[model samples]
Structure formats: structure tokens, C-alpha cells
Target: EAAVTQSPRNKVTVTGGNVTLSCRQTNSHNYMYWYRQDTGHGLRLIHYSYGAGNLQIGDVPDGYKATRTTQEDFFLLLELASPSQTSLYFCASSDGDNQDTQYFGPGTRLLVL
Candidate 1:
């Protein structure tokens, strides 16, 4: 199995709060991703990185920012959080050897009240 983990398994914040979700992959994967899961939208990619310091904007790039500091570490930042952004966030990693295979962390549940 893939070794990916996220911090603050659950979070609660008010509107306009600042939130940060952290992830780390121990598989030495070259590619890492951040995604959000909602009721309607099953899962939407928020951002990704091919390597350290390389940021690639995903389909949903607004109100979210991310950074990959090392091969094993990636972080998602929500500077000005909102209620609509409350959802289950996930972090995934891929070795890049296979285009179809990826490993996902459990998930981080966030609530904006």
C-alpha cells in the first residue's frame, strides 16, 4: 500500500478563518496531489506538484493554494476560508511510473461554520 498521511484528521473553523492542511507521502513519489470531495462533485483536484517547488494549478484553482516543499511533503493552504469550502480533503501520491495508479491518504474533514 501507498504511504500517505494527513494531519488534523478533522477541523472546524468559522467563515473567513484561515486553514492549512498538511500531507506527507513516504513512498518517494514524484507526483503529489490535493483534492476536495463534496456531495455533488465527487472529487475535484485542487492543485498538484511534480516536484519540490513545482506547483501546477488544477481544475478548481480558486480560493486554494498549495506548495510542495520536498518529495515527501506537501501542504494545502486556505488563506481566507469559507463555508462552501467545507468538505473532505484528500492527498494522493503517484510514483509517475504508471499514469493510472495513485495512492490516497485517509482524508481530512473540515467544517466551516
Candidate 2:
């Protein structure tokens, strides 16, 4: 595997809550991304980055924030979490080409109560 790991495999919070999901990739990839998986939604992109301090907004970016502190670290912030935000989030890293061959972290499941 590519050694992409996520913190706090599971999380719970109420509506209008705050949460941070973290991901770290030791593979030295130049591209990192945050995505969410829902039952009927497949996977939706939330945010991404090309390198440290370089952030790119993804398809479904509302109600979320992201920061790339270092090439190995990326974070997803839900300052005012809503029930609709509950989903299985994934962190991935790629070499900036053939994104389909990304290495994915275990995943973080967020539940808004």
C-alpha cells in the first residue's frame, strides 16, 4: 500500500458542530484530496491540493474548509457540521497523474446527530 492513513477512524457530532478529519501520506505524492462516500452518491470530491499551501476546491466544497500544512499532511474542516455532511470520508494521494490510481487511506466515518 501507499501508506496513506487517517485519524480517528470514526467520529460523532451534533448539527452545527465542529470537526476536523486528518490525513497523512508518507508516499511523497504531490497531489492530495478529500472525498466523501454516501450510499447513493458514490464518491464526491470535497477538496484537494497540489502541494503544501496550494489548495484546490472540489465539486462539493460547501460547508467545508481545507488546509495543506505540508506535503505529507492534509486536513478537512467542518466548522458547522450538518446532518447532510455525515458520510465516509477518504483521503487520497497521487503523483499528479493518472489520478484514478490514487492511494487511499482507511477512511473516516462522520456522523452528525
Candidate 3:
């Protein structure tokens, strides 16, 4: 079974700090995505990639950056972070475009002061 996992399930950060949330998958999926879940906004796309070397800008890519170094690993980078960015961030992956089911990680909760 394909599984996506995230680290530091909980996080606390001060304003103007940098935070990195890690995500890894064992299914060797071809597509990976980063999204943030807010109270009323629901799941909003941040960034995604088709493969390790390719990155595609998503709806809310601002204030966030992402990179995929390998097929099994992908990372989300938050620089000069703000409280507005504080939310539950989830990482998901699919076997391919034909696969509609998105396996999501537990998620990382970021709290900014």
C-alpha cells in the first residue's frame, strides 16, 4: 500500500522565522502535492510536482516553496513565515494522473506567533 508520512506532527514558530515540513512516501508515486487546511478555506493547493525534477505552481503557491529531491521524498519550505501561514499542512501523492485517490499524510500543524 502507498503511504505518506510527515514529521514533527506539531510545530511552534515565532514570526519572521523559517520552517521546513518534511514529507515522504513509499509508494513511489509520480505526483506529489502540498496543501494547507484552514478553518473556512478548506484544502488549498500550495505546490505540486509531476516528478522529482519538475515543480508546478498551484493556486496558493505564494509565501511557500517546495522541492522534490527524489521519487520518495518531497519537502515544503516556508520562509519569512507569518501567522497567517499557520495552519495544518498536508502532503499527498497519487500513483499517477489516472489515479484519482490522493493519499494524504497525517499533516503538520504549524503555529506562528
Best of the candidates, lDDT: 2
lDDT of 3 by residue, 1-113 (tens): 67999987999999999999999999979999999999889999999988887899999998998999999888999898999999999999997867478999999999999
Show where candidate 2 strays beyond 4 Å. Answer: none
Candidate 1 residue runs with Cα over 4 Å from true position = none
> lDDT values of the candidates?
0.94, 0.96, 0.92
Q: Residues 1-113, candidate 2, lDDT per residue (tens digit)?
A: 58999998999999999999999999899999999999988989999999999999999999999999999999999999999999999999998986357989999999999
Tens digit of per-residue lDDT, candidate 1, span 20-53:
9999999889999999999878999999999999
Q: After superposition, how far is residue 74 of candidate 3 from its true place, in Å?
A: 0.8
TM-score of each: 0.96, 0.96, 0.96
**In model 1, how many backbone clashes occur?**
0
State the displacement of the C-alpha of residue 31, model 2, in Å, after optimal TM-score superposition: 0.3
Q: What is the lDDT, from 0 to 100, of the residue 81 in candidate 3?
A: 91
